[model samples]
Target: MVDKGGSDTVFRTEERFRQALPDPASMAGWTPRSANAEIEEAPEPAANCGPDADWYCARIARGEANFEAVGEEAQFDLTAFADRSAAQDACRKEKTWSAKYTEAQVPPVPGVDSHAYYRNAGGLDGLNLFMCTGTVVAQVLLEGEGSSLDPATAHSLAQLFASRIHKAAAAQ
Candidate 1:
């Protein structure tokens, strides 16, 4: 009887399942030092902004340096794509299909739900990533046919796309 947000609960559970994850304070392999009882330190001074300065940013900015500043070459610009229209047209073309298969068609394998599945496939690079939502389990399957993409590559690509989707969905 889980609600609409149950996927988040399941995701959180999976994160917690990561073996031997460290505590927040002792994150990864770093152990932060305890706070001292000495007198409070003064706040750091701000940096200068000049007319000659090309760009200014912060990492945790202090003094004359901006830690988070990106160099000119490192700056991101979407103008790299000369044929934006063609790229957009290609992306807009989504290849999708669905089928209702008989129960006998499904293998009697463990860990795979055979109750029902409505699959949808579409992605860039002709990547065969399927979203299968069934009565028992909701699964994402990435398969590749022919010499285009191997199973391992397809699986990795699927994981990358899945991660992007998960991130976008979380933001909503």
Candidate 2:
């Protein structure tokens, strides 16, 4: 979009993804971070698109959740894919570790196909999570003064998001 003189500021949020996105009400303390959910569609003639080219994105979504409380601040992201394989591919490509965090492998929640967690490498007080479900990719991040987001909690939250995705797909 930059090439076209457009920017993220100009991209309209699409409702097509709302059905499968994680609901803020599903978690306690944490509330909606963004005013509304945003759509993340794949570009036409997408680069490296899998068997299903009319894709939603590069990453998949997962189900698992965190109810025990992550911290004073938090956010969630959900990306949809055309098929499970495309989502799986995105999940597998997740970085082993990011510059600011150390990673840990976690088992996939109930219906999730894969999962990963990363804690602030500096012991600062934050955690980031990623997971993959049949046709969606979801992420959760909790941050606060001395806040902690355990894998089990993240898994629980992920499961909720994943179920929504499954339900939406079934409806279609």
User: TM-scores of all models?
Assistant: 0.23, 0.62
Q: What is the Cα root-mean-square deviation between model 1 and the actual structure?
A: 20.0
Instruction: For each candidate in turn, give its C-alpha RMSD to the true structure in angstroms.
Output: 20.0, 9.7
lDDT values for all models: 0.22, 0.50
* Per-residue lDDT of model 1, residues 1-172, tens digit only: 1111112212122222121111233232323222111111332111332223222110111111001111100000010011222222212221111234211122222222112222334432222333211111122222222223334433433343234323422443
Report the CA-based lDDT of candidate 2 relative to the real structure: 0.50
Location of the lowest summed lDDT over 10 successive residues in candidate 2: 1-10
Candidate 2, superposed: residue stretches over 4 Å from native: 1-13, 40-70, 95-101, 105-107, 121-124
